[model samples]
Target: MQVTFETPDQPDVHALIAELDAYLYSLYPPENVYALDIASLLAPNVEFAVARDAGGSAIGCAAVVVTPEYGEIKRMYVRPTARGQGLARKLISALEEKARAQGCSVFMLETGPTMQEALALYERMGYKHRGAFGDYPEDPLSVFMQKVVA
Candidate 1:
């Protein structure tokens, strides 16, 4: 699989994000789902990327939004058929690298408690539990994490 910085509005990438949105909505209430929409992903401060298979099919995607304080991860999703092969790790690493290149040493993200696999992956990647930051209010359904890259 190949992970590269790309536009999120492409057809295949849009499909991937839509699938992710449906899954998240199924698992959480609207207020608990803080995913960035396509237009938001296209913002100047956001860096989005997609993971494609050898045949060039978009199978996974992620984005990092740069803020004055830290890089915030958003819209990270890997298709179900493409899971268990480290695609999520690859996508996240690519975004982190992009952030690091831009001089962002700290990374933060907000996920849901019900997403066990996502929580485990974040923990394995050295993300520690933290309180809500930015404009996010303290919500019981939210899990906030942060990582500092050297």
Candidate 2:
């Protein structure tokens, strides 16, 4: 899968992010979904990446936020039929590249313990468990992790 970084105004990108957000919300409760929506990912410190097929279809997307302390990952999703094809890894790699370009030294993410596959993927990608940060409360369903990006 090829990952492409595009402007927020790009057609279908925002909608795709919304679809991914909704999918995540359905997996975990709304209260446990800590990250903000697509508009939030467009902040000065935030950026997004889209994974497209060889024919140029938007098959997946992920977002990254660069902070002074670390890089935070958000909104990673591949189409239902696209699972197990390494698209998630591509999206993640693109996000990490963007993070490193912005001088971020570490990467953080908040997912859910119920999402075993996602947790495994993140761990395999070098993200280690971490305490909740930002506005996240001590919710049992929430799982936070971070990676020191090279």
The clash numbers for all candidates, in the given order, read 0, 0
lDDT per residue, candidate 1, 1-150, as tens digits? 899899898999989988999999999999889989899999998999899999999999999999878999999899999999999998889899988988999999999999999999999999999999999999999999999988
Q: List candidate 1 segments past 4 Å from native.
A: none
* Per-residue alpha-carbon lDDT of candidate 2 for residues 63-145, written as tens digits (9 for 90 to 100): 88888988888888888877889999989988898789878878989888888889999999999998988777767888989
Which regions of candidate 2 deviate over 4 angstroms?
Answer: none
Q: What's the CA RMSD for each of the models?
A: 0.7, 1.6
Write down the TM-score of every candidate: 0.98, 0.91
Full-model lDDT, candidate 1: 0.94
Candidate 1 lDDT score at position 149: 81
Query: lDDT of all predictions, in order shown?
Result: 0.94, 0.82
lDDT of 2 at 77: 80
